[model samples]
Target chain A: MLLCLLGSYFFYGWWDWRFMTLILFSTILDYSIGLKLTDTEAPKTRKRLLLSSVIINLGILGFFKYFNFFIDSFREMLLTVGVEASMSELNIILPVGISFYTFQSMSYTIDLYRKKIPVERDFLRFATYISFFPQLVAGPIVRAKDFLPQLQRTITFDWNRFNSGLSLVLWGFFKKVVVADSLAPFVDLCFEAPETFSSIHLMLGVIFYSFQIYCDFSGYSDIAIGLARILGFDFPENFKTPYFSKNFSEFWTRWHITLSSWLRDYLYISLGGNRHGTFFTYRNLMITMLLGGLWHGASWVFVFWGFLHGMYLVVQRLIEQPFRSLMTKLRVPTILSAAMSIAVVYFFTCFAWIFFRAPDFEIASTVITRIASLEGFHPSTIISKFMALKGILLIGVLLIIELTNFRIHYIPLLVRKPAFRLAAFALILWAIAFFGTFGANAFIYFQF
Target chain B: MKQQIFSRVGWAVLFVFVVFIGDRAGGWLCQQIVKGSGFRYSRMYTDKAKCDILLLGNSRGLGFYQPTIEEITGKKTFNLSYNGMTMDLGKVLVEDYLERYPAPERLVIDVTMCDRSSPEILASFVPYIADSDRLKGLIRDTSYNVAAATSVSHLYRYNSEIFQRALYYSNGKSDNEWLLDRAMSTSTLKHTENQKYRIDARFIKELKATIEYAESKGTEVELVMTPYYPPFAKVVRGLDIFHEDIERGTGRRVRDYSYAIEDPSCFGDFQHLNKKGSKLYMQQLKADGVL
Candidate 1:
């Protein structure tokens, strides 16, 4: 426990040693709060302690991540009314993984306040749980209930665990270095100057970006989960082919599952969830999603991305039944109906991703306008057909592997069968060498 | 625990063995595809592209437009140009061309190819590395990590935009028509407010070496700046400086056609000319005795 705790701190402290104090502060605060909640029979005191924990964790997160954001926004508001206000924005380097660790720390106190989980008394064990190196940065946001017990169990080196973890890590690296990074230059080029590119180029850029963010974030989660497994811990899956989701609700469930579930459990339910009337349920959903979006970054673009998704969910609820009935009446086969639904979900998701990726509203609007105009949509107009072709080939490879894995569950086979294990591992290593973009390219979620 | 450890180590060794076999097999297949490819570089290396004139540049060099040049001058032409090609790769290709084929009558180069150098583009020349020691050395010097990667996994040498083009032009597909076929979009024209390109001394040295080598082989080397849109040409910075540097470095007068084409319809983009533009430019080149 001490070794893991020190190693985790060292891993984080490597970036900025000053930020180590922040992690240490949060760990100590939560550890004390957890124990206090357990000892106190008084409900009031326990609630206050929990509140204190929440305040300090979020307080730290906000000051580092969103202080300049709020100030700049306020200044912008004042400017709109012709009341010129000058606000000095601080140059704050947001410590990497602050959001993930803060949420993970908060979940422990929140669950303890509800008496859903026992308070961990071991300081080192609790600290290790908070700072576990693998998921410490960009997380699956493992809860105390799920992770604390694993700390209690004996951590033996098992071959089965090693094999499965190795495969997962290999697959994750392929998605990240090969697929995501290969798409990055083209996406960056198009986004850097949307007006310069043809309509087909901008459209392809948006599509490539959607997959880039997906592969990037999910690839980190996979590596984190696999690393944890190799060390005798289990992390809940974070993504499940989210683009294949049939509806907005299903998309939320599939994409960033941990963070969405965290919001659903803590924020949405606390805001008088769907048990209330439809209007309030919609309100709760909007608030939760908007917060979720803001949770990603300090930008209004992220909030607008959240707003679009919130509207999608509300609008989908109102029309889904009628749409399904219409499809049934039209005698659409089940496969075709499913295909249509997936396409709709993916298309809207890609649309929202345009806002998420764009530097600001103007660039996003330019991209959308150019794509909508359909000027120079011919193949010959694409500036870099080589890049476009490479992106397509990589995406094709990813889809084939994912679709095949969906049917066969080859992950377990990669663990159980020697021949399968050898082939799969060797192929992944070869693919990484052949196609991987080798640079110190950090995972996209590392900023969050 | 001991048995599990041994089994794991045993599997790891077996994995390495399998990977080695697969890499060699995959690399051989790719080499065959490359040799059989009608892609310009493949044709150059395979001795299928001996001609009276050689054209070299980045994508801008493609404006030399082989089909029109062939028709106008009635001389066999081969373009040794690739998109985003750096000077390092350009020199290697030129030197290799000089070594493999009898000296062509003339070699036309777009001096703007020295504007930028890209390691990624140099790395893309990995598939042709086996054919030239100069290419292997240049790639090693510029991007040693990529060179190491190619050595580790031979299949990696074949993974690039260059190789992808090879596959596209494989099985006897002609690559003579490889040019940007689009006309200028209004947005592109609007966005081409002043732009500057820096010419590195090192790249100029590479260009000088290439020019000297072609000249030594009794090949008349003509360095020219391709035509840009008139509007774009008005605001372009550093071309006079680049021209001066190229002229001083190579001791050859660069035929300046940067503002030669006034018709915007001829331009594909600010940096390149469409087929119409290339045709018009070719006529100018012929009239000026630069063809």
Candidate 2:
């Protein structure tokens, strides 16, 4: 994992060489602390060491990620005071995947101290478990309990698994190159410079961006999983037809599955979960989700994003009886109800993504204001340029595919019929190779 | 276990065979349609050796250069420009044309700074020559055309509809029809201006290679910077350092026609020429003995 991170750091030119040295230092410290925590058999000493590790890791994360944000807010407060002061704006480069791996390592030590899982005897395997290349940069945030066992076993090659993995990788490449990258130009044109575009264009850009991000991140996860599968490992599924989710709760269950489940088991449940009472349960849910949002980045936009999801869950809980009664009164079909719930969830998610996609709060506000204005109603140009007919057809195709066989398991089955499967593969490859807009764009979540 | 393994292997092999056959059939069908059509430019440069002159560059080259240079010089000519083509492509196109056709008597290249400097564009041509089938399959499949259809913002802002219409109308044409359209289109040609002059070493190197290839073939090479609007023209004109760098890198003289004549009425847009402007520009080129 260390070697791979170093290699990726060099390959992608993501950060300066100094950052790589900092990462090495941090890793060595983490290892020594992990060893010391597991060295003792006494429950009190082990708990103390584990607690110290958590504090140290969280302290490092909070300082590097949130120090500037907090300082700026303080500076604003200081301006009202008689003494005017200014601090240099620290241009700190947050280490890639620090939030993810720190949580992962902390979970390991916490689990060991609690006697939930045994400490790994082999340090190399333990490190590998923490920094597995497939999920190192952007992750499923593999848990020690889940991933460590897989590392302990010797790997063997399987042809069936190899073919399935190869297919998945190719599928991921097509989704990224053909669907996501192609959408990027229009999305960037609208989002990066929204002032020049109309409200309609802004809306379309957001819609395209929503799809672009989904395909880009999920496509990356698929490739990662496929790669690991080829190497005789089983990483957990990260996405599961998230767009087709019926509600916000379901969406959380489906999208970024590993992160969602991790937060649920480790954070939400630990914070009194639903055990403390209804009001406390709501508080726990809100706090856990808001922190999860902050975990994405040290910005207010992420806070809003998390808060929106938390709001959704809270509202759902609050109106559970009323919503059920309304559904019953409407005589809405099961499918219709599901569709409406999905649409509402999707709309709210898209609204939140505006914050995720925006450069800052000001721009996000501008987008909302502009979208509300609906200033120019020029449909002809958009319809003509976007080839309205073909665009609709493509969307129809995607929708059908998503609706019919949204599960990953179906992908392998669909490809089992040799002739049709091969033809589909060829077509997808040709489309990606010829139609893909070749740009130097990494996956959107690479920043996270 | 052995049988299970054998079955999986058999299935994989069958899959590959099916794909290979499908791609070949698809290519043959597209070729047949293209050949049997009344398309004007499709078959004109199908074999390069027969052509007398060749024009190379990106969309600017395609949209600006008049193939009438062949008629004016009483030689067969073809524009080998592809849309969004880069300097790297300019190099490959030249090499490919020379290999396929006799060295032309003259070669005209349209130069752009952005296209020249982009590494992505440079990397595109690597697979074209190295993996011929991969490229051939891409073009044959018309996936770009499909993508162009689905992309709304690309169409409205970029005016790709004009190109698409032209492509559609040219469908199903014979070689004779193509030549006739070429002749008819030449008279109404316009000259446009070049904007955003940015230069890279790779573009300069490619331009130098094109010049060398032309000299080797006993052909004359003229590097033309087409006209642009006044403001953009000023920008291009201000690229003296970039121009000097190109000259130093290429070891060749490049003609600057960006400011040769600036009449606002001649422009269709900021950088493109009207029909009258193109004819006037061509006349100027003829007078300068650069045609």
Candidate 3:
């Protein structure tokens, strides 16, 4: 266990050696607090212990990640109000994996204080839980409850499990290198000069970005889960086909499943939840999502991205039953209705993605305004942008594969056929060499 | 359990082995296209080139380096223009060429208003600069980690367009960077007023140094503004300012050729000339004693 913790630290140190200290600091604080929680029965002492974990973990995250952002914004605000307040922005490098590890570490004390999980007596087991490298940096944000019990059980490597894990890793690589990276340069060009592009190119940029972020992030999650499986563990799925959701609420439930569930179980229900009627519920929803946005990055654009989502959820909540009834009254076929709903949800989600992608609110507004005030609708511009994205045909293939994935019940190998498994892997390997975009592009979610 | 694990591992290894053979085939195919004269640098560096009039600039330079110019001038010529080849890359190419090859008698730069360098352009040239310490350092100075990896990784090191040429378009051979006969525009082109051409001081300084270096080596350096479609040429931002800077910096007048052609069918895109346009351009060059 100690060796595993060392290996995890080494994996992190590969990026920057200095960041290992930050992870250690987080682990020690939470570990000590968790032990204190178990030792004490007094409510006041237990509350203080939990607060310490919250303050220390969140404090480190905010200081490293958000200090410069807030400082710059404040100075800009002061200037706008006819006051000169200028200070040099601090030179602070946000440690890679700081946010992910901190959140995973803090969950220990939070869950312990709530008496939802036992305080771990074995320090090595707890330490290993904190810095398990596979999902450490970009995570499914594995909980202590899910991971700790697995540590106690005997880990036996199943041959079938090994094949699936390896296969999952390959699929993740295909999604990331072939699909996401191929789309990145095109999407990047549009966002960099939103004004330069016509509305057609800008629309393609946003729509393409929706797929890029999905494939990029989900690809990372798949790799992480696959790696964990090789070590004899399992993680919950991070993404389903999120773009296929009929409404915003269903979208949340499908996308980033662990983070969504974490926010619901920890942030939402803890804040009096929906039990406190519509007004408070909306307030809570907004707060949770705004913080969720801030969790992504320290930018106001992210906060606004979260704000749009919060609004969508509230509006979706209001219209949920009515939309269902309206659909029933219309008596359109179920498949047609589903297709229509998916189209509506996907287009709106693409609208939200503009803000998510834009570096600032100004650019976001520019993209939105330009899109609304369309001068020319040229299919040629859209086609040219797709041509620039060399692997656009692969997107159609990927979509077909995704749509058929679960429904294809008679897939050879996966139901214990070794030859088919090998064939599948061989085919993917061939595809990777021929179609993959060759680059070591940093994962998008790694910024958080 | 151990036997099962070993078998799974064996299949994985076999899969990779097969893919490696496929990669070899793909790479060999790329070699065929990349070896063709359509890719200018590959031909220039490899073929015995009698370099007397050397053309250097960005994509504009490529379009302006008329194939007929060589015949008209009775001098062997090569176009060193690259797509998005900014003043940054241009300067390095200039120094690198002087160090390695015999200096040309005349260096004609097909000037554009703005030249912006990016890591993408720098990275694309990584494999080409494997033996040059100064070039490796220049790339590293732009971006430390990404440049370091880009220089080393086989997957990232190779240029893709040239690679694609070898695979799909090797058979379509051309003697120059562009197919002059193909008059085409892929999309509607327009000039937006808000799009200002921002100048980099470093690029200007580099341009000055490059001209000085060429002049020191007895190579006459001339900057030329190639012909643009009349409507587009009228609104090129900092067009006058760019000319003033080049002339003012180098103390050499920028020979003006822009807006020389009136025929609409001669133009390809907003900036470039079709074969018909090039024929007219060649006649003008000869009349002006530029050829």
Candidate 4:
């Protein structure tokens, strides 16, 4: 445990040695708070302890990640009205993984306060839990209840686990380096100058951006989970073919399963969840999603992305019964209705992704207007036909694998069949060589 | 435990063996597709394409419009141009052409292709490396890592737009219809200012070498600057510098026809002409006795 702790710190500190102090400070604060909460039985004192843990951890996170954002937003608001404000912005470097670890530490304190999990007395084990390197930077956000017990047992090397884990890691690398990175250049060009490209290109760019972000982020999660499993630790699956979801509610459950579950369990339920009336239920969902969006980055665009999703959920709930009745009246086939729902869900998801990807509202609007115009919308008018063809081919390959994997959980099965494992592994290796764009592009979620 | 360990090691060996055999087999299949392709490069290397007039440039070279040129001049024409064809690759391709077939009566080059060097596109020519030592040497000189990658994985050689085009034309289709056929967008015409082209010194040297080699092989080499959108042409920077550099470097008089086509409907974008514009420009080339 001590060696694992050292290695985790070393891995993180390699980015910036100075940030090690901040992580150490967080670890010590949580450890002390965990002990203090355990010793006290008074409800008020426990509440204060939990509140203090939340405050200090959030305070550090806010100072690093959001101080400039709030200040600049305030100045902009002041300027919009006729008042002049001169707020000095700090030149602060956001410590990498501050958001991930801070939430992780807060989860431990919250779970302890609720008497759901025992307070871990050993500092080394607690620290290792918070800073486990595989998911440390970009996370499945492994919870304390899921991980702490496993740390108590001595782990042995197991061949079955190793084979399955290796399969996951290889699939993750192919998604990241081949599919995501290859789509990036064409997407970047379209987003940089939406007016310069044809309508078809801009439309293709938005679609590519959706898959690019999905592959890039989920690819990281797969690697983290696989690496954890290889080390004899099990991390929960973070994604489950999210684009295949037929409704916004199902989409949320499948996409970023850890973060959404975290928000639902802790934030939504805390805000008088669905036990209250429908109006308050809607309010809680909005507040949770808006905060969830802000949690991703300190930008209004991200907040608006969350807002669109909140609206999607609310609107879906409002109209779902009527829509189902209409479909029944029209005698729509079940498969056709399912296909339509998936298409509508995917379209709205891609639409919201525009705001998430665009630098600001102006660029987002330009992309929308240009695509809507449908000028030069033919395939032949696409400027980068080579890139377009490549992107389509790679996306096709991804869909084929995903569709097959959906029906058959092949990664686990690979452990049982030597011939199948060998063939699949070799094919992936060949695809990587033939198709990957290798410039050591960082995983997209590292910023969060 | 001992048997389990041996089994695992044996499986690992079998994995490597499978990978090696699969890579070789896949590469061989791709090579066959490329050789049987009707793509321009494939045709040239296979000794199936020869011409009285040869056209070369980047995308702008596609403006040569072979069908119109052939109709007007009553001569056989083959275009050796691909989009983003750098001067270094151009020299290798043309030298390879001269070596394989009889020297053409005329070799027309659009000098604008010397604007930059594209090692990325050069690496895409790996599928044709077996036919030309010059191409292999040039690719090695430009990027040894990419050349090494081709050696490591034969399938990697066919991993490019060049290979995609080969697959596209592999079904016995005519390759001459490969031209941009769209009208210029209003947005492009409105925002044509501030565009600049910087000439790479290495590309300039390669252009000079190509001219010398073509002339020595008894082919008359004509260098010309293709037309840009008229408004874009008026405001474009570095054209005079590029034109002068080409003439000075090659010691050949370059006919400047950059303003030949003036219709707004003739352009697909600021730098390239649509089929309408290419046809118009080809007429001018024939009338000027350059075809």
Q: After aligning candidate 4 to the native by TM-score, how far in Å is the CA of B145 from where it should be?
A: 3.2
The global C-alpha lDDT for each of the candidates, from Candidate 1 onward, is 0.89, 0.65, 0.75, 0.90
Report the C-alpha lDDT of model 4 over A92-142, residue by residue, as the tens digit: 998888898998889999999999999999999999999999999989898
Ranking by DockQ: 1, 4, 3, 2
Best by DockQ: 1
| Evaluation by DockQ, superior candidate among 1 and 4 | 1
> After TM-score superposition, what is the CA distance of residue A109 in candidate 4 from its true location, in Å?
2.0
* Model 4 docking grade: medium
Q: What TM-score, computed on C-alpha atoms, does each candidate reach? A: 0.96, 0.69, 0.78, 0.94
lDDT of 3 by residue, A94-191 (tens): 88878888888888888999999998988888888988998988888889999999888888867667767777788888889878887888788778
lDDT of 3 by residue, B1-291 (tens): 699669767877876775566555544554444555344555544454447777787766766545677767778776777667878777777776766678888888876734576766665565445445666777788857646654333334444443443334345454463534444342344524434456677777878888899888888887887787776666767665777776776677887777787667786556667777877776776677555
The C-alpha stretches of model 1 lying farther than 4 A from their native spots are: A407-411, B1-9
Off by over 4 Å in 2: A1-47, A63-86, A89-94, A276-279, A376-379, A383-397, A407-409, A414-439, B1-16, B27-291
Chain A only TM-scores, each candidate in turn = 0.98, 0.90, 0.96, 0.98
Off by over 4 Å in 4: A84-88, A407-411, B191-194, B248-251
lDDT ranking, best first? 4, 1, 3, 2
Considering TM-score, which of the candidate structures 3 and 4 is the better prediction for this target?
A: 4
